[model samples]
Target: MALNSFPPGYTRIPTVSPGPEDYPDDTDALSRSSSPSSSSRRPAWTRSFHLAAAASLFTVCSLAIFSALSATRISLYSQSGHALPLPTHQYFGLETAAVPPCKLWGPGLSEARQNVEAVFYIDFESANDPPLHPDLEDVAVWLEGPARFAADVSYAQKGRYVVRYTALDAGDYRLRVDAFRRTQTGKPYAYWLPLGLDTYNVTVMRQDGSRLRGDGRQELALPKERCRGDEVGSRGRWVRCEDTPLPCTRYGWIWVPRDCIFHIYTPDELAKQDLWIALVGTSVWRGIFFAGVDHLFGPLAANLSAPTSKFWKCWGRLSAESAKMRISYLDFRQQCIADTGALHCSGGDYLANTEKMLGKMAQERGGRGPDLVLWESNDNSHSNYTMLSLYRQWFGPSWTGAFVSAFRTYSPEVPYTHQEAGNIAAYASRNPEAKVETLDISRLGGGLFDTMEFPLKQSATFHWHNKCDYEGMHSCSPVDDMIFQIAVNRAVERQRRLPPRAPTPPATEDVAEDIRFCLQCPPSLDFSMRPEEDVQCFAGLPL
Candidate 1:
């Protein structure tokens, strides 16, 4: 019989759409169809039901295939053996066709406890016949959320890259892992360009697995005695100490001066009062600026342009209703020259420019200069020999003059080079009245003296090269974080010594009368206020 033919007891049923309810079985339909009126309806309903079932199965199969091809191929596994779902793939590269493939392995769980360390492993391979991998330094990992910080990245076994970091606060974060390809052109020196990016979601929880409200409480502290100014040991060498525990653990294995404390000021603590901080130095200062801002705020926008002028300046401001803090970075290299552009590393031009910048800041704030000024000499611009000569020549009157001026005005904190630390110490001894305080960051790494001839990697007791670039000139995030911590710690200490201001009175005719008693408030008087409430107040204001 033909394939389309039906049995003799039944009449053929025309095709029709399936209804919401399932049709009766074919055998049941046949029995019911014995009646002439029902025969046509039952068979047609049965056929439609079969067609709908077949279509549904086909649709499911097609969807499964599509998802298998489009879903992310990477896998993430946490230390506790939990697996996290991969996020949808996002493209990041100069050319789509040239983009390489990458695989990631690490803690799969999306949750992490505050102050607990998290580690990730990633590897990249080109799509070419023989896969090529970039160097360890080429990989960059960025963690952004309630707290912004740099992850310590290093090479792992089997060509895998390992990244380690600690979440300082509890919140949702995005961990971005990027692979880059280095390219050098005649115009621009060697630079790395992104080849791909893999982003993962991370939820940092409090130590008890709860949520954290504002910037959480202080995670780490140091002994009060250890918080003094950097000390110099025998032979004028800055006293060295073991690695201190930073909130992020970025400096766990790094060595610093004995007096270096890792007390990071949170945005909540800093938001208490209006402050103006100026960082003056060379290109390295720019990196410090970015690192410092990243720690306090979230990462800066990727499209933000860097300053490129001769006297470049970049400003970052944190504005609150009660407090406003401004961080400004100025290139001091151009300031060391005379008005006629004559180069004099030991001339008064450097001090003149320092005063000029401070004057400008005071004008902006109604005659209040910057509350804190951290100065790092622009030694990166000059050769080691030139710097040594300049340090020697300025040891007498020029050095004393600048220190005296800065001490009297701003109580500036200066971070000196390893070679110059001795000179700074000697100057402090000869001129005890100047009250010179030096933050010795020279022991960290990437100093001008650590050149090719005297490689810090070979001679340093601890591993310092990993935190610095090839030339030992530019430093990575870890070094920058250390410098920022030291600078801010000194700033906080200075702020604590200042006398509390009278509370501001509400705008009223009796405002002056209300604040009269506070006009001569003693410096030793303790206001007993919370950090966030420690704002400057005028004398003629309500208490």
Candidate 2:
């Protein structure tokens, strides 16, 4: 992990074992003090004299040794091996040598409708005296949301400072901590400086806590600091903005570069990552768009035998490296387990199925959690009511969920698409954490059914291949397949651009509001002819 080369025989040792004087350049000290012949001729007792008196010469020697002993250090743990190596003076700067690289800790999980524990650990670099506990007022811990809530460092013991915050509602949240010593004049500590900064994401739950997943006690990598200023005075402010302001993704769930909002993730970017994403819900996620005469029938339609295995094309052009996606289907009234290990049957058992998928996700690459989770609900559910509740439980009341409306239906009574524009507004009003706007495939209004002349005459059915030949074959038209591919591809692109879940503290507020506006909000489509239907058709259209 050390980026720079050391002396040919330089063996890496625990930093505490060496004093500042023990640096490899000690020969310069001997040269400056005495001639080489005289130094070599010096008695063994004289050399022993310097070693014994080293403690009285430089304050840094004692400070470094005791600092290493007293400092409570936190470490990162991840299955993906994404945690960045600790920065060192050789690679970063000598000024940073005294500052401990901030460690990010804890994969915080929310027990739905309960509380989320956001804990931060820091090394008290200068707290040498056990009798006096370090004053932490200068250290700040906060949860970012529409309104920032500062956390209290309520406990400190054994050189470690522990700050704990209880999440009030379910939604996504970013947890941040800033630690630094200050001068007597209230500025940052200049000499022998000690500073640590970190931020991480935390998801809280609103409903059955069991729906939440992951072992909350594991440590996650802290995000890399973006603004590593050498100066001491403004260290606090600079470290807080560790994440450079990137243009927020149009849909909100992902973070994209300022110039790539509409374009989303490029193929190259996806190809370079080692990530895992999970999709859990009902038939909508069970390769609904890939169902056709050429594919299998029912919920497992997309899972084909070797002879007809073309359904994987649903992912479109994305071919990222070491990327895995876990997809699951849950039926209405089915018993499902939540992340909290409780069983729930509401809303098509989404919570349970999602939790189950999380379990499967953990088993990948030797037990790691998914970087992102995407769930598709049945059309019959109210966009605002069901989505917001579910979003609150997964993300927290302050974090937002991405809304994606189903495709429009020709039959008015088919329980058609969500009025995305209206539903987005409604969900946002009640749940500000609902940050990601709905990706409405129905935006292709009239385009799918429009008329156009081509040099080669086209068929009346617009290349229609099958008309629901099998029970779960929702749409078999080649055109419909293209449309579905486009819509879902856009969704994947949005997710692909999301900043790697590691290297940054999980902070979920209206990140969308901070960087960009919704490029295209859901349109106010008219659904006047749709029949009054309270239930979702789970078994598919009559054959």
Candidate 3:
């Protein structure tokens, strides 16, 4: 079977229209000659009996005609036993010639969902367009569903027809259509064909946008040679004519220029890059900062920024650098792992969401992992910050061994703030072989800035309060974001220069000094949060 075509079970039912000679002639209904003259000569009793007998015979014939007409209307049913009403064919007289032959095709998607649309065009053998047949019949298309739902369509363009009806509930749907040509006596003669016969399941998801939930629904999946993007609607490079000297149209392909394309790196290409980072957090990362965050970089730029209702600041420098250096920076800030041990993440679980975001890349690029992943967690936050371990595990053994803590942000709340920072930093410290980095913005006075706005605004300079100076949770300022970006870029670049698969330990002391002056910890410290919790306080004492 073709990847996207309907299965072989799809078949067309043939309907036949009877000719004028098919019905028996009504010889008994013929008028009698000289009826008035004969009645006058006959006896009154004889005339009365003749009238009574004629009346009885006429009533019987009328009843038989009604039964025959009623039998023509047929009811179609879905495979699931949902019944749909077929249109009543009104025939006027006998047909002289046969009904023009045409095939019922489709269940094609329409922008409107309250309807069933199909085509009744005649199939031709040649590549050339065929002329419409003069004797072709008018066709009707209708949709039927569960609960006796029925609708007929009168609107048609040439051989195309659209049957509009009330929005149907979720269930099986069947398409019933007929093409009727007029006999010389004005009688209708045609065929009524059922196209899909419930073999095609019709699942209607039309509230936001219309989508079907059946296996036969159409989705474009272009192979590597056909399109640059792994899936449909993804921005990608198009194969040009010069690339392979192949006709773009012949193999069901179209060539688009590279400049007109959006550069989307496959997962393998991203893994091969000097830097590929994934940001994990909450509303701060998902809705507020992450949406359209990629637009700030690359060739596409709109000065548009996020809503002013939150602590989001533009990442112009970071995005620009990413574009220039071709870095892959991903954000996974959606809510995950509620405080009560529930995994309410998008698409069900952590791994599911991960696959949703990167599975296509895995399929296209042959299973590769990102180079660096920067995750965020706040102890005071509602989420269970320890769930990061599950996320770490989801990445699996190839990427989870390093634990380098280079920066810290501090808050006045002693162990609550310190403990929160320790929970995240210490977790990283335990993984000696994984190439991961942790910087507690809260420990480095990241929470000290004014909660309403960034202290540095759009400044590229790395600046932040050396210690906790603000009262509430130190919301990260614009400077903190920049510092994180700088650290990530630096680490990725350093990793790129490292010997293949060698333990990528910290090589420079620059980051140690960067976080040291911001907050003071004991000269020597165990990577543990609370003495009672039995958790490591730091990755390795940056002091």
Candidate 4:
């Protein structure tokens, strides 16, 4: 229910490993054999028949096994919109936001003669998407078997919520809960990404410079609290305790492999799931080694410069492998919306590309209403530029709302400046009242971001057009400054001040149609894969 994710474009690699439906039925096959000698003594033809028969039997057994496994799974669905189970004997509690035991909830189980419990611990940090349970009301739980529920809003537990369930019978059963939003609106959802890639350096050294294509080896990545910029890029934080970094690295960057694409040779069915990849503004632009669009304070330097072949090489691979061709650009747009909904755009100066894509769909479908739009990047550059002048008056804030980088943190030619990044942070920090939540659309695909004052339950928005810096043991060409600036605007609007008294209009038939159109918009093609055709300007659609 909570928007606890980040920007999209994850690599969904096709695995040869067994899926949830696959199971080993070799138990029966092995049991039927009295001894290896007897099995080997069977006639060749008979043995072949036995093998084929076992294979067929295994297939059927697998299905039965799957059914049994699924039946035992803690599926938490509710029909009455709500319900509860009585406890046989046990206490209830909440858990932390870690991965193992893996923040799960299950129906009551048993150990020996004693009754066991289901732990409902929500990990806000480890979650890559929105919070499993959004608002408490949006949440509904039911315990199978005879059930009774115990909840106390009366006793103050401080920041966390509490619930308890008990069972009355010995029969086996599960406890389930459906999470949703009950309030009109709530706090934003944020996620922490150890290895965020936006921009980077082409000449960066590998974390250990040991292997050609590894990010080192480690069990868990350390959190930001324990580290900073000095921390290696390949790993979150380098530990002085161990001679090695928190985790080691083979590549100079986080997720970008030596091939430069995470999701390689993916299948179509898993394409949607591969969009979880993201680019974080934790570092500035690295156009010097990336797209060659460094931000210079002067007029001449302002324009994009020639980029190295490596920049295009990396970009080309990323485009083809990413779920949507323009992964970084589109995901950034969606991120802002997912964090806080429409509230993120009160001042309305921020420009997000995914939002523009949705807006274009709404227009194409002939739905009309008050529309605020952000521009798209990579492909359809002019289409985005043209939308600006289409309306005589702008509904959102003007250029004044944009962030202005204050100083240069990077010094190398084409290097990203912290001053540029400062601009984004400054703008967003100034607009704290923007009520930026839900407008973070990217939550539908990847991450979440909240305000700086709060836990960030989501992500930090807004940044100057700085490239991704080479941080950590491993390094990478960071994201483009242009895109970084766009994210900054998106983030700053998180705190934009709104004009009082504008209630949201009712949902109309057009809106319903618009929603459908927005969802159906096919993924954009990669900029590197376009046909070499010239454009003869035909009558194009207008905003």
Candidate 5:
């Protein structure tokens, strides 16, 4: 959009199209020229000769044309807005509510595993960009705990407009801006923060002290202990005491800050979110879910594939946008199907190929075939009935066999699941001499930002994935968390209700499975890559 006017007031800002030459008075030109009357007065033969001589009269017509041009400039632009007869404001400049959009840099975290990390970036270069609250300037710094949503803050230097958050134990945390200044006018400065997880403003925290903030406004000097855990830089000397030093040019000081505080998590908050997910989730999906395992294993980032080759072609990409999905569909195939190099195939074939497709991920990975093999050595068939019965009960009274056709296939290799492994798990329970207690999968621990490839919304109880979304050919949108949570919570409950386990039909697919969804789903951050640039969960959308 172009400007309607400059800073000062002046409606005289008319279309100054007509030039001074177009408005020439021409009075002096007339005086110097011979008059037409004088030319007509010449004698007949002489006048004929005189009329021929009157060819100079062309100058007379030129004067009339110039006068008309000046009239137009004065008429058209003298007034505007509602005064025009035709549509006047169809493309008005100063009236638009929309602004140029800024791209949302994805969540910021790096695998180099440094002392600090950048979670995401927000571009703020638009007329409609969310205004920077004046309060932000007044906020000095602060600390936050689990109950608090604020990330711990630190200063890169005195004039920098940037900051970061840090902690010791890993989980989730959010950054908040709480600047409230008092003025004699009784006005307020900026004061807003997000309330819950739906905004995806939902944060993940850890204990590195090295955290989610960084700035080039580095200090020229470094404190003695600043480089303790960090390596010395390229320069012979590790410290540079000068201010405004070049970026990556030398090392600077680091510490925790104090306006950047936590929102404080409480048992009450969990109660507010409704802890019912724990009670019924297990009966939905058993060993296939990773959320339950996530709690046990720790944050997902800790267990991330280690090398660049292990990562989604981590070396480099064509762009900020391209890099986001650089891991092409072909690669998804090679890794899950063709590249049987080391059984990295999880979701098995059910994740990618249709159940009707030629191959079954379950057969390849799930006890060498899709169908469950019953062993007489296993429980006397009562075990199989127990599982199938529970599966049928959980599907409720309305499902067709569709659920088992799709969801039942081994995901990520049938999960080494007792239910899918069938009656044997129950028989194993019946046998007195089995060696181990039960399941012995890994634990969830390690670095911050540990997350599954595809995190599920809280409402998901259990559902089946077509080969396209899961393992068959490595299509993504992974939902290991929901299934994990369901199983674990059920296991925890079993501690209270021991075996002679109830029956559950493992195979079934239905939309009704999702019993609840967050009523306050934060409006999607379609703006994360657009103008609203930030989301509004607590403090009405910033600006």
Candidate 6:
């Protein structure tokens, strides 16, 4: 596939159409001359005739000038209706300078190996044209393939530029190069200025120079150390968790933030906890729940219902004699309506529904709330078109900002009122005993800005292309698993710090009695999942 062939819903930068000013101005030439003959030598009637002719000529010239100006104004007004394009090179005072095509020289594309850094050199050398000097900082280099890689660029001796990037997975990848230059006013280009998008197709192979082969049965393990909340939002790249000499598919990679150690608790450690965990959020949280279950227990039964449902609540329980754990997911969007048997929300109040569910959970536990509540709401808040005004302000004239603005204009979801962050803070303050942690999964998937980082904050380019669903709302695999690990680790650490709670009696009813059970399910909760197979689990007898 062409690297420039962006997915549906993305608007490519358009070339600016030539305006009226771009065309040559039409001039109406007028010749003026004075006769040397004196009026005394001519007849009085002749002078009168000459004077009348002069006045007529002046009037004709004035009418012609008015017509020309009116035509130019109409032409410019018509062109203004078309879409505006990026500024031309002449606007940047580089009209005479030639932009030479950037050339790449380094190891062959097939020689790239996984986990090994691939080095390449770029130079703007041409036989016919003189060399061009562009600020290395203005150039942007990134890769699109099975993994996320940021090609590092630095100036070498002379006019050569060295580019370095490491491949994490053995697969085909594309190295995309683009450059941006500021105008005389020092403002960056408002759109993607393509300096050289000479896409290089690279086939990354394992160290053994063999194709990666594996059934999906590889057992994934958690890292020993857990990533902190700050690290979760920090700048980082995706890297294979286990980088053995020989490439293996046993473990998937994780996004490790800068200056942080990211590892999850082992299954043994997770099995030792006896706690009730409640996950309240959008569909993304549903994926995290399944990923956590897969890591803690074995794969779910294949015949279970789909990951999503019309019902508001579902439960996953590990009823072991020694260690008991019950995880309940409350769908903030869905509400069970009595007697209708249809999936619908009443008053469209997500926060109110979430609070109602929490109260119900507490009532079921004999007035004791869940030990830990991992909460998030409206992961699709940025996708709402009504918020385009706010997005334009939040993300200014960068390339990502332009793309986001166009996306909101062209493709937008039904407007959803996002829950206020302060409301979450208030809830956490009210429930001092319970560990109420808010997870910003959107930031992990690059839906929000990273204020601490510059380019990320301004460009919003830290998106995990390979790890996100098509709409870029929910995160797939290792990312979802990472989210689960972080939530569990925080809960475990909080339990160790606080006093042990009095054990509550087992519920008189089974929470999963009406719901189906499944061992096999994709570990992401994006909208593109199995939509046709959704099954509803009605609300059974009240708690």
In the range 289-346, model 4's lDDT, one tens digit per residue, is 1221121111112112223222221211111111211122112221122122222322
- The superposed Cα distance between candidate 5 and the true structure at residue 441, in angstroms, equals 21
Candidate 6: where is the Cα deviation over 4 Å?
A: 1-226, 244-251, 304-322, 334-353, 362-368, 379-476, 496-543
Local lDDT at 105 for model 2: 49
The regions of model 1 sitting more than 4 angstroms off are: 1-225, 229-246, 249-260, 299-324, 334-355, 363-366, 380-416, 432-436, 446-476, 496-543
Q: Model 1, 3-76: lDDT tens per residue?
A: 11121221122212211111111112222212122213322211211212111100111222323331212111
**Per-residue alpha-carbon lDDT of model 3 for 1-543, expressed as tens digits?**
001111122111111222221111111212312112111222221111111211110011122232232121212111111011111222211231343334434433222342232222233232222222323333333333321222333334444334444332333454443333322322221121111111123444444555645421132122223222212112211222212222111111122221222122222222234443434332233221222222122112212122231112211101111211222222333335555556455334434645444433222112334444455454333424444555555555544222223222332111134345555556556653344445543322311222111111111011221111111111212223333333343344335333333223222444321111111111222211111111111112212
For model 2, what is the C-alpha lDDT against the true structure?
Answer: 0.29
Number of the top candidate by TM-score?
6
Off by over 4 Å in 2: 1-277, 288-374, 382-384, 391-421, 434-437, 445-543
lDDT of 6 at 115: 62
Greater-lDDT candidate between 2 and 6: 6
The lDDT, on a scale of 0 to 1, for candidate 5 is 0.20
Error of 4 at 186 (Å): 56
On lDDT, the stronger of 3 and 5 is 3
- Give residue 471's error in model 5 in angstroms: 3.9
Q: After superposition, how far is residue 186 of candidate 1 from its true place, in Å?
A: 9.1
Please list the C-alpha lDDT of all candidates, in the order they appear. 0.35, 0.29, 0.28, 0.21, 0.20, 0.35
Model 2 over residues 1-543: C-alpha lDDT tens digits?
Answer: 011222122122111111222211121222222112211322221111112211110011122232232112212111111111111212212233444433444444221232445555554544453212244223445554321244545336545656666544345565555443322221111111123365566665544654344422121111232211111111011111112221111111121111111211222233233444334333223333332212212232322322223232121111111123222222211122243433344534334444443344344333334334444433334343344344325433322223333323211111133254345435555655544333333222211121110101111111212222221232333233323333334444344333444332112343221111111111221111111112121121111
Model 5, which residues run further than 4 Å from truth? 1-162, 167-470, 473-475, 478-490, 499-543
- Candidate 4: stretches off by over 4 Å: 1-221, 224-252, 255-270, 273-409, 413-416, 432-543
Taking every candidate in turn, the Cα RMSD to the unseen true structure, in Å, is 27.9, 29.6, 35.6, 26.5, 34.6, 28.8
TM-score of 1: 0.35
Error of 4 at 287 (Å): 6.0
- Error (Å) of candidate 3 at residue 124 is 94
All candidates: TM-score: 0.35, 0.28, 0.28, 0.21, 0.17, 0.39
What tens-digit string does per-residue lDDT give for candidate 6 at 315-426?
2211111245545554433222223333233443433433444444554433444555664333233222222222122212221101111011000010111123333334
